[model samples]
Target: MHQTSSRLLRMTDDERPFTRSYIWPQYALLFAYPHRTSLFISDPNNSCDFKDLFSTLMVSLPLTPHRVRFRMIDFTFTSDEAITNLGSLKFSQSNRMPDPKDSSRVVTTTTTTTFSMAKEMARSVCQKFFEAKFIESVESKIDFQNKNSVWQLTPKGIHILERFCSRNGIQSAHVKAVIDSSRNPRQLVILERDIDTDKLHHDEQTVEIIFRRFVGATVNESLSADSDSIHEFSRSDVGVRMIKHKPSNARPYEHVFTGKATVDWLMDCCTMVDRREGLEIGQLFLDLRLITPVDARAPGNDTKFVPTKQAQYYVTVHGQQIAGWTEFDDSPIPADPNSGKSREGAARDSNSNRTNVIIRNPSWRLLYREFLKDTMCEENLSFYLEVQEFRAQYTAAVSITGDHKIETIRETLAAAYGLYNAFLAPGSPNELNIDHALRTQLATRMTRAVGDDTAMMQSLVEVALLFEKAQNSIFKLMSSDSVPKFIKHPKYGPQLRGLDAAAAAAYVANSNMSSSRSS
Candidate 1:
């Protein structure tokens, strides 16, 4: 390889960048450091530092390496002018910046102004958390919209956020702070005329969230108080409640149901949306008691069947399967039996299939007599699917939509899944003919300097995920706009979205109280 700049250092060791794996402990290193916020971007500004850090990870390598690259079919990571410069980012410190009214950028149609400023602030804080986690090579993009609310992170930025959230867990205020940190009216864009309640189904939980945002909860307030929610509060100051690192919305509940239908129903139940966002509630109350047919069937299953009148859905992530529900609402069975088409139709209808991840696992069962301790309602979720089982069962169940954007997304997921497929098959990225090509392409001059074969190879998967995560972080920055972006159109891909955590949950179910694994 040839080089040109004074800051760039050439490497002598051919094996320096070479690594057997880069996945483990990646999250650990990120959380340990929290002040630096430049590792998320790929900027020329941090060239020298990136070169040094590449040399560090190479010295220590994992004993057992597991790697696979899944291909997400029908996913669209590709972009034309419309979505161009959306995902793929490459910024130079130019003296000139785009004017919002410039010919290149157009707000042809006015977007509904429900965008959340707190969510935007949260993205920035998350970006900082990620940057702090990195050792070096941090490039920061503080202002996304020096033009608008779009913020970019350095590769350093990527390293910090990716691991911090993974290790420390996502805080509600962290996202809010991201929005609050960058509150410049001249630069920020929030269009708030009115929201359309008709677009959302009436949901009590949904209504609660709306009111919670408009007039958020606090430790001082009663858990059952909706009357306090009726009085108007400043949307900006309303969500604030302090945390170890930042102040956020008053109360942050783990939302079990992120579904639009469910949330709309919850909103209409409380009559909050119309009052809060200047929206009008329509005749959605009729369907409040009804449970949709699809809700009856499992995500990867056909032939919807109600779980039994005595059945109620319970959800929990891996290791916490017996914990509690993020939501307590019943899965309303839809009255219209033919309201939707067959299982095949549901998968293709992006709108319908997109949010099935919200559903609880039918396989979820409680170990009532033994480990069950808490009053918190518990249901079991496990993730044990055979390739043949997944394919044979969900083949007809999975949508074969060819939407390029969605396809691109699916393709990316496929890369990770390929590794998963290979893992059970005892396969590797090479066996699947997949390498860290996605990540290697963005090493820039600095990563290329100290990055060796192993590091480069490990970085391949890390970088690919890093990019997708960068996209996730950018959207996840704000609670209102960003949260919906990730939960709405997940980049972890759809299959991951609907993760009952069962497959993983089962693995860690009884082991929750077990001693931690020894190094």
Candidate 2:
């Protein structure tokens, strides 16, 4: 939205058309992609800007650290064999002496230094040829484990040895020294401090600086441990260590609509956002209380908790592992296109690419009533998870049903999708703004009022019970004093006792009426 300038032809920076026909929306939409966005239409009157939406997603982006280090060589070959051709390592050219009786005989001297160099050269050559698999590169180091004979890296890595340092409001070069030592550590996997810390600003340690120091030159290319090198890392001000990194992460809102936290860390960092053309961002907020179903036993037979997918995530963002992203994509650093299809395709590709498939351990979700707080959560959470449930009901409502309770589920799935931001969140992305709640409610009410009546019980018994509990909620708006007063004429009350069933029927009828009025 633009405020018409009093000066007609006057132009401000935001509205200036960079391209011949393009105009930048003043407020860019920050979308929390992977969100069910069709919900925005629940209240058709509530218009939001198309530009304010944004999706910050965790992409498990691949990384290929420029430097690499190995602690224990896993090959069956001996260390000697590992360095066989690097230099004439096994050959020694030292002077040999005969017995005293043969002292007069000539003494011969052999050259060992040249042999050692030759062997070293051979080792380098062999590594390039056969171990090329280990030479994978990345934008950053990756973390992984192995049973034996294998080393792995992940996008989940930290930079080492060549850290940047700053102190007293001024950045220093010393941090670089720390980084250098680590990059070429003498020992493949030495403790962080053991490498070198001599010249660091003796007293200060900020997380940013610490992060760099810890991640810097740790690779085993060349242990750059030198007194001069130690002197290179700069120090920091006095109170640095106490500072903790404020992860620029949003909660994983995949559960904005349903699910016990399948992945806890992810949900807490979820953020909600939106973006569209021609409008200013009107709303963006965390549902701090986005609802999902609780753990329950099987209806009759099972005792162990089996969490329902209701009120759980309606959508999810899939990504590759950080360490293997590059091996999968052949690129050390990955880019985010914010295209839901692309990211999902990448994930499917990578998952299918695995030669060994491993199923992760499963954990249980505790009873929601016992562990969670929202009183009406059960009422608000999703109950019907399948589209078939609505088969005989409203077609529009049935279109969005899913087998899995996800971050979102609604009637406009075909036109809506998730977006992912690469930098902020690692696994889950922020979401776009959509009036999911309002729209869902409207759909629920509409379906009950006009479509199939039986499915209403499957969907909204909880709501009916709530009304029963707080009878005042039902009568409060019906009082004669309220506008559009309930004309309680003698004819209106005939056989009109507010039985639960009758009330349910009336609500359905009214809901249909309202939906039609709006349309």
TM of each candidate vs. truth: 0.20, 0.13
Q: Candidate 2's C-alpha lDDT?
A: 0.21
User: lDDT per residue, candidate 1, 154-185, as tens digits?
Assistant: 22322223322222122333332322333211
Best by TM-score: 1
Weakest lDDT window of 10 consecutive positions for candidate 2: 51-60
Q: CA lDDT of each candidate?
A: 0.24, 0.21
Candidate 1 residue 481 Cα shift, in angstroms, is: 34
lDDT of 1 at 9: 18
Alpha-carbon RMSD, candidate 1 = 23.8
- Candidate 1 residue runs with Cα over 4 Å from true position: 1-201, 209-214, 219-393, 397-519
Question: How far is each candidate from the true structure, as Cα RMSD in Å?
Answer: 23.8, 33.2
What C-alpha lDDT, on a 0 to 100 scale, does residue 313 get in candidate 2?
Answer: 25
User: What is the number of backbone collisions in each predicted candidate, taken in the order shown?
Assistant: 106, 111
